[model samples]
Target: MNARNAIDMTAPVQAPRDAAPASTWHSQMPDDKAMLRAAAELTRDIAVARPGIYWPDMLASAFVGYAALAGAILVSHPVAAVLLGLLSALALYRALLFIHELTHIHKDALPGFRMGWNLLVGIPMLIPSFMYEGVHTQHHARTRYGTVEDPEYLPLALMKPWSLPVFALTAILLPVALLVRSAVLVPLGAVIPPLRTLVWERASALAINPQYRRRRPEGDFARMVFWQEVGCSVWAIAVLAASFAWGWCPLLIALCVVSLTAFLNQVRTLVAHLWENDGEAMTVTAQYLDSVNVPPPARFSGLWAPVGLRYHALHHLLPSLPYHSLSEAHRRISQHLGEASTYRKASYPGLAPLLMRLARSTMTAR
Candidate 1:
């Protein structure tokens, strides 16, 4: 769900006609207090995370994903394999996105849901919950939301046009990169103390900011990271050994499926924000405006931005609102605030326009 830091800036760039002046890049927008009050008072009832929804949805998604992956690998027909692979990618993508929820929800909200998720999806996917737990919360911090300290934010709208494609495409390599990190670099780092420090700081978090170095995990988090690291290392080594001992076709197919999933997530991340912030500490209203919401009638927003992410702008408003409750929450606030409200400004019709707008913004970046 985080943007990848890959950009090819060698090409000649031209500024678009609508480009804003450099002096206006920092958000000076005042917080909309009425909208903020409505958001809090309207959604207080649905703020709690429901375990029933979380457990069933995650279990089903993982089941369907693995089943479809098995079908993709076993089916000899090229067309059938491609179709099944795509299905696997989408289902797993949804399952994997529960990691985002894990970060926001209280530790006691769902009891053992965190450990269950790791056993089922996180460790198996080589993306244990530790990578996101401490990291994503910082992105939601009041003073750090769009600043350089925010691991998930990047000023893509201020970059060269070519950077977008490169940023998106590079995510295809993430699965393989994670495999290398766990199977190769991690094991090596276990002996070399300096290398261990370097890997933990630089490669541990799922962050977009190239300069965002992670601090060492501590207490319970450190313990969790230790176990997750062991799990990933063992899993990765076993996978590589099996692939080598047998033919590499199955592993290759699995990697390709995961790569497709990562690519889809990267594309989703691209449109999740307006990406106009230039590292300034934004106000809450500014953060919400900078975020996006592809509300109903878009139809396919659910497919790309699952687990309440389509209401990302609303999420910035109420970070603890459970995924299943976002729609009802959105409706209450929207009707209360009316069409001309600042809340309405964050809602977009669909993905195409968002993409076109981002592309245009990049074209105008100086």
Candidate 2:
């Protein structure tokens, strides 16, 4: 059965943190050559991937997403169109896994063939392979407090009763944020050169401190961020060209589909880190326990958790493994870590109700 089918994403997820830390939670997932072992295991199992050029799965899904968006625009039945668009959005999230693979693996090592193929895979997802690679690398190196380690989680103190209103408002506002982002913000940010330059400068400064600019220009990082945008810009241009010569519907459909996928991606990211508190948890596990992932032997899990994010705790423990092999790596290690691995199967719909449940729980609890 498809792992996605195994998941009941729509039903209620049990309150995530109600169970006290796993019997083994006190023992952190091992980090001793874990990344190395993970890589070897994953490579032995998952297909030897071909980057830059279409990853067979990600490519097939990208076409599905694009076709669905087109259908959403032209198809007569609104409901079927919306369903297809939703499925496509989910498929696009999986496409992000190929991008994650590029971030983790060195493209040159694989096939002496197309290095550009690695970069090409990242564009449609709006992620710069280089920038994200660096950021995510640092994130894995130290998933804790202060400076650049954290993967952008809200501060734990953020869940005060007073803050409840804020999380609720933000949760409600998410869908609207997607529309504004894809339709207005993303498109405008691309067309306006001044805005684009400002963003680039700011990102460069962040990637490497300005004081160290002379030391590190982030050739890879900047290129990653740049081409990622370039891809989005190209996508935007295509939509506009079609809309102008034809009609607005196609463009609107494209924006809706892309944004919907991106929004779901964000939900997965935030929740992965949402429940943990700052001090000890940050120091030890970094973002591993805070992150959620579906383990492999179940690749289909990517539909709900992009980039093998479901196997996140395992990845954090073993960062060097290429994404394609995360599943097997996770499965092998999971026996050792057990629930300390944070391998839950809550459906996304169930996840929402669970999040709402936690909104009322102890700030430190899940």
Candidate 3:
């Protein structure tokens, strides 16, 4: 999706004075199908036509070595432990970037490269990269329809004006949220039957559906999730074993699990679309609901926002483009989309502001 010039702040910027902002133009819903079709033209190589050891890839290699060193430092120096926590946070962020792709394409295009990459990247991040592919694939396929399952997205209406209070409460209770992610969500992905059932159900629904059968199911993003998770799980277990032997269980645990959740990945996703007209056909995860491009942490977070994730609208509109080319597509989309695009910038952010905007911004909805 191309981006547009910043809203003319100098202009009155009156949202149609007489008409309801709900006018269909506010629906400015890009012809998602058309965007997907254009993207299809470029999906031929989801990764680079030739994957080279670029700077990010090299940084990825350095990270693994850093993790190994982190284990030792965590026991020897408390400051090192905290610093490792930050580093782990950074690594987990990158892991999610791997997931963005895992959500987009299967890893079989270049198995040798993919397998090694997944093992190297997924393990330290504790993502179970392989398993994520399958589950996340299903997520993209049935996002809003049946997989109404992923609800970092609760209807703001349900919360009412109280939503603000609730969001405030949540900000303080964030540790609880992180606890749920680590103790519950991640573990369930590893051990529970019900969670696996969710994955299978999502997969089955997509398998039988027409629109979803777009890319081959096996090679779909689901597989990418599955393998990445697989690798992450293995690495996590290994980290535990090694740490236990080194008598650094607590430290290693913090590095592998606690810090992973602290990466704020879930926040990035949840706030992206937390409060929208949940009644309308939502894009599966509220993650697709509302998002902005060129957010605050662009340069620092670029590696973590794979496939032009900062270009959320574009990424959602055209998931097939190689991560590198998303910028070009986003540029084009901007010119065509103009102000039809929403959230001209990252004005209001975090769950609370987003919820407030959702309520006020209902100025319009499709």
Candidate 4:
């Protein structure tokens, strides 16, 4: 079946019903066929991934990030170092998010882009493409989304208020955690069979769900994982060795930069979804509503939610649409569907309101 046919978009668009109870909010909504069809038809021309855009953006972001990181480490002035470190974190965060595109782009769409990204941003960051490749796809699956099976989801809005802060704060330690995973656990896993299994199943993927356990990799994917693990291990050990041999200043600065990047990502992830569903599978329209879109006028969203992630709700509707094309795709669909359409319901004004909405939900959550 074609992409349009894949979604059950036969039902006509209707006024959104009165708010259901928090637990059943997403489960009861039906698909919006008019919005779905408009999205598919209006975006056909721009759907193809463009290598020209992809290569330059990735390369420039990587180059600027590494350069800023070097300046942060080498410059003696504390003020200059702080500015440079911030720049490095933002640039690298954008560069690293290309992994999201890698998962959706066809293998042939941009040959060698995956390897290029893994070398430039992935291994050095200790978050190789393999970590996200097979894992993130599960989040987009029809039946598994928002379920216990989904690696990328958790019902945060329904949890205690403290859970939200803890969820975001934990990401600040990711760089150190990654260092230990690669430098300590991975090397030990090479010799210990059980440790290898445990690490692979529990620590391999970039997942938010604590209960999700990854299966063993096989075929080409297994080979890819082996090589990526090797690269990360070697890089992690080298960084540690260099830190000890020289002063710890350089490594500490780099870790701080990565920590900021991770923290920003965690906050973005927090706002990406409404997190209202209580372990129930949602229809396409329901999923879109539960997700979010910080479109135009959300000035800072592009910095935090780079690489088309600002259109995350729309992304659920068209997972395979190239990142570079998301803005145009969003525009075409919004214009075609108009203000009263289901498509408009997903778009938010900015980040502050979304965060406030999530915080309010947590206060009343059962």
* Candidate No. with top lDDT: 1
lDDT of 2 by residue, 1-366 (tens): 011134443222224333435322223434335434543454465544445434556567666766766677778898988898887777765664555565566555556222343344344444434445544554455534222234444443234645544443343343343334434565576689765554444442213222221123356655555555556556545655667898877656655776676556555544454344433334333344344454444444456576556666556555556565666665565554354323333212234443454454435343
TM-score of 2: 0.64
Q: How accurate locally is residue 131 in candidate 1, as Cα lDDT from 0 to 100?
A: 93
41-72 in candidate 4: lDDT tens per residue?
A: 88889889999999999999999999999999
Residue-pair clashes per candidate, as listed?
0, 12, 31, 0
Model 4 residue 315 distance off true place after TM-score fit, in angstroms: 0.7
Which model scores highest in TM-score?
4
Q: TM-score for all predictions?
A: 0.94, 0.64, 0.59, 0.95
List where candidate 4 sits over 4 angstroms from the true fold.
1-19
What's model 1's overall lDDT? 0.89
- Give the alpha carbon lDDT tens digit for every residue of 1-366 in model 3: 011123332122234322433223223433344444544554444435235533365357447545744563556776776666566655555544554564464354434654554555545544334434444444344334222443223444334554434443443333333334434455575578766555444432212222342222465555655555455445555655676787775544454544444334544453443244343444321233344455442353354343356566455545545566666665554455454433232222223343345555333332
Whole-model lDDT, candidate 4? 0.88
lDDT of candidate 3? 0.44
Angstrom error at residue 351, model 1: 0.9
Q: Taking the tens digit of each residue's C-alpha lDDT, what string does model 1 give over 1-366?
A: 312112211111113212545435345567899999999999999999999999999999999999999999999999999999999999999999999999999999999999999999999999999999999999999999878899998999889999999999999999999999999999999999999999999999999899899998889889989999999999999999999999899999999999999998999999999888887887898788778888898778999999999999999999999999999999999999987787887887777777878888788778
Which of 1 and 3 is the better model by lDDT? Answer: 1
The lDDT values for all models are 0.89, 0.49, 0.44, 0.88
